[model samples]
Target: MNDKSKSVKFFEQLSWGIWIWSFIALLCVSIYLSVWAPLGNIAALLVTGISFAGFYSLSIKMRTTTKIEGQMLISNKAKIDLKFIKSATALDAEGFKRLAGVDADPAAFLAINFWSKTGVKVELKDKKDPTPYWLISSKDPKRLVKALVKAQK
Candidate 1:
């Protein structure tokens, strides 16, 4: 069973003015290449098309939902759903321990490039199909951890 205490959502969208300006710039560049340099036009068009497609794919993938529940962490996206089970804490534990038999700092190891600046750490469990455990950085880190602890109980 899962008990969702909090939910976070993130979206990627440019402002109207920025989007318009970007479109205009693209149009102008396309015109210049098509008239002034026909050979380069094909390469430019292909590159621009690929770039737009890549951005669109990234935006779609970035749409995600993160839910922290009792002993479970859930990350949902358009393609797949990931689940992570919490590890048991010791009688006298300081912080989250590294995965079984693995000697790496969970914080440094799970730090991803795209979301690293957000101060979030995501570590995978040691199981065959291990789930990812995340330590998200928040202005109120204590409060967030407390909330997760309360939800576990």
Candidate 2:
């Protein structure tokens, strides 16, 4: 990690623990089915293991972390320069929904997770990019917006 970079993870570790528990439940179902079906214990385990690996891999990919490094906002889907960012504001649940839904710009980048109801809305200053802003979900929108403002300076 760079000293100047501020990292904010969108999900709590406990939330990720749910995924692990879900995987265990799936494996249990597989084991139970193996007893009544022709698939057998080994086959059931193999199939469940493979499926779980793929599911976990995708879950890891979907987990997003936002990083404020120097003048840039870096994440899985977008990298935006703070120089082009006119403002960063923390949104309430209603504001987040409104900005992400009816009032949203068609060209703006969005990295949203259904679990997170509040977010940070970043307005782009550069007219050439076509994207008016970015709406990114965050567990702590206030801290994220603050970090963005600090990085801008």
Please report how far candidate 2 places residue 43 from its true position, in Å: 0.9
Model 2: residue 64 alpha-carbon error in angstroms: 1.2
lDDT, model 1, position 149: 48
Residues 1-153, model 2: lDDT tens digits: 565444442222212446566766776676658653886777777776776677677667668677775556876657877789898899999999999889988898998876667888988889788888888888788988877776666
Candidate maximizing TM-score: 2
Tens digit of per-residue lDDT, candidate 1, span 1-153? 333433332212222234544875676566556654655666767766666666567655544444453344443421212233243222111133332215444333231223212223344455664334444333233444444445445
How many pairs in model 1 have backbone atoms within 3 A of each other, for residues 3 or more apart or on separate chains, i.e. clashes?
Answer: 0
Candidate 1: where are CA atoms >4 Å away?
A: 1-36, 40-46, 62-65, 69-71, 76-103, 106-111, 118-143
Question: Ten-residue segment with the worst summed lDDT in candidate 2?
Answer: 8-17
Local lDDT at 53 for model 2: 76
lDDT of each: 0.41, 0.74
Pairs with backbone N, CA or C atoms under 3 Å apart (clashes), candidate 1: none
